[model samples]
Target: MSSIAIKFGIGKSTVSDIVKSKAKLEEFQTEIDDGDCTKKPRVVRKSDFPELDRAVYLWFVHQRCKGTPISGPLLSAKALQLYPRLYPDNPADFKAGTGWLRRFKDRHGVRCLSLQGESLSAAMMDVEPFREKFLKLVEEQGLTRHQMFNCDESGLYWKLMPNKTLVTSREKEAKAFKKPKDRVTIMACANASGSIKLPLLFIHKALNPRCFKHIDKNDLPVHYYAQKSSWMDSYIFKEWFLNRFVPLCRNALREKGLPERALLVLDNSPAHPDIVSNIYRWIDNMSLLATQHYIRYPTHGSGCS
Candidate 1:
């Protein structure tokens, strides 16, 4: 061996060690082959898939776009099933699905289907200053001046809960579920004065204008319907404000002791008729009383109104 190593320009000890290791390995292989303890083929676990993390992110995006409720186990199962279709031969392993989703959610701030209490807290923090300013304005204006009212329409869905419920992590937890297709209209008016009135009518179908049919000359108390594209027609504004909102405002002043020159605020929605016509009419009609009252905050002030 030493003579052969010298001739090949290699160290004799290095060659000998390699030969001895090979012999030992061969002997071990023989012993294993002769024994009943057969070596099992190594299985690639879900964690072995190189692209499992990427697959989980894609799945999450898909579900969010579709407005689907998602969870860790569900996402993992979905990723495993979809991996084969999306990546073919390099599908993600099933076992790593949950871990990938958890990591993805932590890194990206993906919210679950149901909002958590912490979310409400975050929103409150953002709006707290606005609320404080509003309260101060109300205090300065007095109850009559601040007569804040909110008018909006809500959809009453089938099996809707009357109140919000708490959520828990228990399996088979009771969830508030409802049929989305069945819904009814519920228009309501409420004020900071603690007065609330339900609309006299409710529409069984969403788009039916029949609920608004009764809002004619007799019921025009400062018409407050949301502006729609159709209301932008040449004569719609004149017809609505001149015939409706003005008359209602006059009547409200008489009945509610609202100042004759009360300010009327509204959004700058395209559907809104130009303020010039309405202002002219109010000034012409109310004269001196209109001096103290003028529409202020013409843009984005509808909420306060």
Candidate 2:
């Protein structure tokens, strides 16, 4: 191999690979004595099937741009679909399996990490200031794991199906196939330790639907909040924070032997009001009612959490 590398002026590893295969012309010139000569050529992917691979890459890029969730199986199925369309006469014997998908990702430097939907308009400089403020609040308040909580709102279309499905033979599409928009906005709150999962406040469209005639509201799994529009308004938001959220957080903290105080982190939105109508902010003494009245929200002047 060293001799071959010296003679051909190629790298030793490359020469070594060829030495086991390529022979001195004298040995080849004599006869086809003992060497296997009918092996398939090594596949150099860059030069191999440029059209097919590029289509797959382009599809992935397009999906990412549109914020579509692309899984491994989804890409594999897409590759299979693209093959026949890309190459009509010459159908390549390519298996877009797990091995192929992994190699493709490595080759293209495609990253598969957990994705968070942050505002696209938000700048990099805006993040550090927010982080500093949040940390300062934590330090000043002396908040613990049980006391610190984050609440996020999301819409879930419970009875919806993904747009595409694999079909084996000649199969028919479902009757009146359409993407579902049936949704309910849910407010979920949990602490850093994840020891407690609070009762999810599901805001549904129907105020008094016919379906719940037999079902008891108290016995329901989720804390169902009713609204005609199924949205979080100032009134609904205040009610949730004051009535449901405070008591739950207090109970959770008490169970864990922590402080009654909790830092509820919420995004700055129109639904969150600056002032309560007739009551004083902060230490609102609710002696008439048994419940604690210290459910604090950020004011408009104080701004974002």
Candidate 3:
């Protein structure tokens, strides 16, 4: 052992230990190699069936479609619950489960590709069909630019735009004097014959009948003005339209000396009691003032906008 160590430049103790271990391992190998040893071929368990894996993947896909973020561990747990016969083993195979899910998603395009609601994508897809219907309606309704006037209420925040340009500290400090509270301005406009009416601008803490009192029977056109308002469950909408909106339209039309065959385009909103009562009374009385020149219903405002 000492001679061997010197030849190999190793310590005698290390050389003896290595030789003894090698000899012991060789003897063990020779014994194992004899008939006493039967080396059955090692068997590899096949991965879970593709169909089961695909089903698990689909489950995750559905959850994700509904805005749920399903991680691999969660999916594996779910699989165990759903298919105990298949996933009865340890959940450490979560990586394999997630891999199957990813494969299924890629193959079938089952993942949601939209950031917005599914309805938004559906609406976008329906645009072309909607346009075709709109054209048909326009023809059937005999709508011309002169006959159709667009009216919409828009809101504006009354404040100087926040300066985007970087300002020195001194400049900001100078302008730090208390700024006025921002105000919301609601304005409505009607356009006809290449002319737009002087916009009706009002600042109200909220939209209500009182806020719209300025619109009386004097500001409307005789022909239909396509006015748009949202559906809010309040009488204010009816009060504004019946008492203020329609009257203003009539008065404006009278002032323009145009005939009263005006159509008011409004969404289906429940009228306030006052407006509903007024409408009922007008209908009962069959009064000329109650007679609408024309009222056109809109399926939607896609083309109108």
Badly placed stretches (over 4 Å) of model 2 are: 1-42, 45-116, 119-121, 172-176, 275-305
Q: Which scores greater on lDDT, model 1 or model 2?
A: 2
Question: Model 2 compared with the native: what TM-score?
Answer: 0.55
Worst 10 residues of 2 by lDDT: 285-294
What TM-score would every model get versus the actual structure? 0.32, 0.55, 0.34
Candidate 1 collision pairs: 46-93
Candidate 1 residue-wise lDDT, 1-305, digit = tens: 98889888999897797576786556545634754222432221223444655566666778657645566667667666766875676543344445666544444445455432222223335356645654554465443542444433344576555546566767456556653555554444433454323232233432326666655534643333333321233244445445543454455555666654433333333434465323424443642111111222221111100
**Each prediction's number of clashing residue pairs:** 1, 0, 8
Instruction: Write model 3 residue lDDT over 1-305, tens digit each, in one string.
Output: 87888898999888877676786556445634762222332222223555565577667658667655445456556655656456667445544356655443343334333243233223345457645754564475554444334444334556656534567766744344455555443535464454425335343443434544767523444211222332233444444555555555556655766554343333223432333321323322222122111222323222100
Q: Top TM-score: which candidate number?
A: 2
lDDT of 2: 0.65
Question: What's the lDDT for all of these models?
Answer: 0.46, 0.65, 0.45
Deviating ranges (above 4 Å) for candidate 1: 1-99, 102-143, 146-238, 276-284, 287-305
- How accurate locally is residue 201 in candidate 3, as Cα lDDT from 0 to 100? 36
Better of 1 and 3 by lDDT: 1
Instruction: Quote the positional error of residue 90 for candidate 3 in Å.
Output: 32
